[model samples]
Target: MSDSENPVDIFRGFLQVLKSFQILIILTALTGLALLVTNGMIDGDWGRLSGGWANVKIFLSESLPLDWQVIEARSYPVCEQEIEFFCSTAYIGMLETIKIAFVATVFGFIGAILLSSLAARNLSPTWLSILVRIILSALRSLPSLIWAILFVIVVGLGPLAGVLAMTFYTIGYLGKLQYEAIEGMESAPLEASRATGLSHPEIFTNVVIPQTGNHLLSQMMFMFEYNVRHGTVIGIVGAGGIGYFINNYLKLFMYSRVFSLLIIIFVVVVIIDLLSMAIRSFVNDQGDVRRPSWFTVLLPAKNAVEIHHGSAGEEES
Candidate 1:
């Protein structure tokens, strides 16, 4: 009957949890299999054909000379000369990449605020929260590549297409992330704001928005990082960036140029990582893992307080 000898309670709890999880797992697996079969992915013709994988490998070995060019034997001066083209194109491409990411992050951050404010379960009505959630979901359902492709068609290539595509895509994704962050926040401060005759909009601006700004900015940085990675490939769809260099060099079988462009991308990503980390460290106040979502926004209003009758229950334990 003692706590240490609670075998019956443990057995029943474990069995119920296991049974529930087993049912969920089985349904997920069956649905996955059904989708594969419905899509013809389970067709024997698709799997039975070994195709020309082996033949293609043999053909390449036969066609290409075994004693063909080596990097050391090829003119070192000529290799160095080729490297310059990659560096130049890659530098310009990298700059454009930064521009696209900046636009995307900025746009998404603004959009996240508006959407997240409306979607906040504590600060907004159920209808507003649901509407914001639906809008965010619709925006996020499509990959950024589709936006990039669509913009490429409308804008006719260049960084403009890349920027627009990345911007809208970021808005959709960040809006949802920020909304969830807001919902996960502690309700005490918001409730205090509400108790003081602060309107929903006022509570959001004074309490929720201020508290969540850092989390929002962190999400924006994450979105920016994603944009930097994705924006490069969007150029493949005629949205000008490093992907264009990759495509052009790959088509001509210029692995050296491709390699150089890849190096440029790595350098840019490294720089972005360093900058973002520094900014985050500077903005973060509490330095705790479980930071309140709206802490950054509240930093500015540190002296501001909402009078409440009894807040002892809500204080940190």
Candidate 2:
């Protein structure tokens, strides 16, 4: 039989067509589901959506040149006013937001370190690990916004509520990340520690923690950065931050002040991102070459010495 008419070729072609049809069906189903959700639950109207776009076009046409020119002409005065506002109100709000994030992250990191150690499959009993995994998973499933709303009701609307929400969310997030890091650690060091008749805690402190210190630090920095952004969002529900002011500005239609606040937020986030990057780079570079005092604080001096000796013995053997 010709190649085109061969049974094997026909079967392969049929399978390819079946696969393509399956993918098409999946895409169609997803599109239909999205439409249904938007229409039924969200009350989305395509006509209104189009009208909104038209309104945006009109606003852009009207505001682009004349309004922009006016703002530019009075830019110096506007800048002075914004700077004063920043110094008086926005700066304090920003600082409070940072404080909330820092405190929450610290508490969360400590909790995560404890929970992750027990959650790790290689470190703890199977039952304990499964239970911790379930708890962390449940915590992680809830968004920070929901937690913030609940806390707002309980605590009566403040940064305290934000702190609690962030702390719980961070624990779940960091616990999962850290446990995976612990589980992925080199088996050799752990084996050596066990062979040396070290206790579980001793092996974990000396080998697992030191090996995964950089990963933990990186995860902490990431969580802190995320919390900073999320902290602003949680404030929208009166949990306390720059978002409270943003909501106020929106209510009053104070677009210029809102724009200024956005710029300040952008600058702050950028600075934080850069600082985190620098710190991560420093950790990666100095982590192995020389154990910094901070590193020893986590893995004590005696433990470090013992680990070094163990590694040397392993190499010799």
Candidate 3:
């Protein structure tokens, strides 16, 4: 049959047309959504865009008579002294930021572990799981920045506010991640554990924890890294961290000091990211149940259970 008269060819052409039409519809929908979300940003005044570009050009121009130059010229004579002060203050502020993130992550992870145990569908009772899921969903609905603002207002201010905000937010975030990890675990091992007449706690302490340990640790490390970055942002609202110094410098137009402090923050965040990567890689390489010695010590029974499971699998193979 001629191609145009062929039924298969006609059907194929129809499908191609339908695919293109579907794509066009999707693109149109996305474009409308973008416009709605941006609230006229995309189609705003051309004059404002021109002015913004002009300001950006002025910022980049070395010959511009900027206020920063005046400040630098005045401080040139005492540049060495200024460096010392910047270093000391920035160091202290960064340390405080790290402390806040660390404390928040530790407390949050602990809370997440507990809550996630009750939230996992396979491990927890239906009512308890549903309740925990609802609580977690509510917590996760708000951004960390919003939580920080509320805590700052309630607790007054300082690292305490930052810590509390990070803690609550992290619990929600980590709990969701961990319970997902638990639910995503291999059903074979869990079923085997259940068939052994083990109690719920025993199954969780053995099969659940061991099977998902790597995922839990990896996610926790990521959360800690995320909290470090978030801690700085929350400090802008007087929650007290390196961001406090950043805000102070920006307000005072101390661009040089601000630049230096930004570098410090960058270095700290990069170091944390690298450390997390290394630890995650190490855990992944060391086998499924591999974990830190301290973790093994804390849950010797879990480790033994994992070993038993491993041997059982080998025997089946």
Task: Give per-model TM-scores.
Answer: 0.65, 0.66, 0.70
Per-residue alpha-carbon lDDT of candidate 2 for residues 134-213, written as tens digits (9 for 90 to 100): 99998788888888998999998899999999999999999999999999988888888888999988877878888888
Model 3 weakest lDDT span, ten residues long: 66-75
- Output the worst ten-in-a-row residue range by lDDT, candidate 1: 66-75
**What residue runs in model 1 are displaced by over 4 Å at the alpha carbon?**
1-87, 285-317
lDDT of 3 by residue, 1-317 (tens): 78798999999999989887997889999999987877676675556767798877754463234232222222333445444444355666788889999999999999998999999998888999999999998888988889999998899889999999999999999999999999999999989988889988788888888788779888988898888888778989998888887788778877667666666777888898788777776656556553544434566787866766676678799
Which scores greater on TM-score, model 2 or model 3? 3
Candidate 1 residue-wise lDDT, 166-230, digit = tens: 87788788888887888888888877777788887778777776777677667777788788888
The list of candidate 3 runs beyond 4 A from truth reads 2-5, 13-51, 58-87, 285-317
What TM-score does structure 1 among the candidates reach? 0.65
State each model's CA lDDT, in order.
0.73, 0.80, 0.81
Which candidate has the top score in TM-score? 3
User: What's the lDDT for residue 97 in model 3?
Assistant: 88
Of the pair 1 and 2, which is ahead by TM-score? 2
Model 2, global lDDT: 0.80
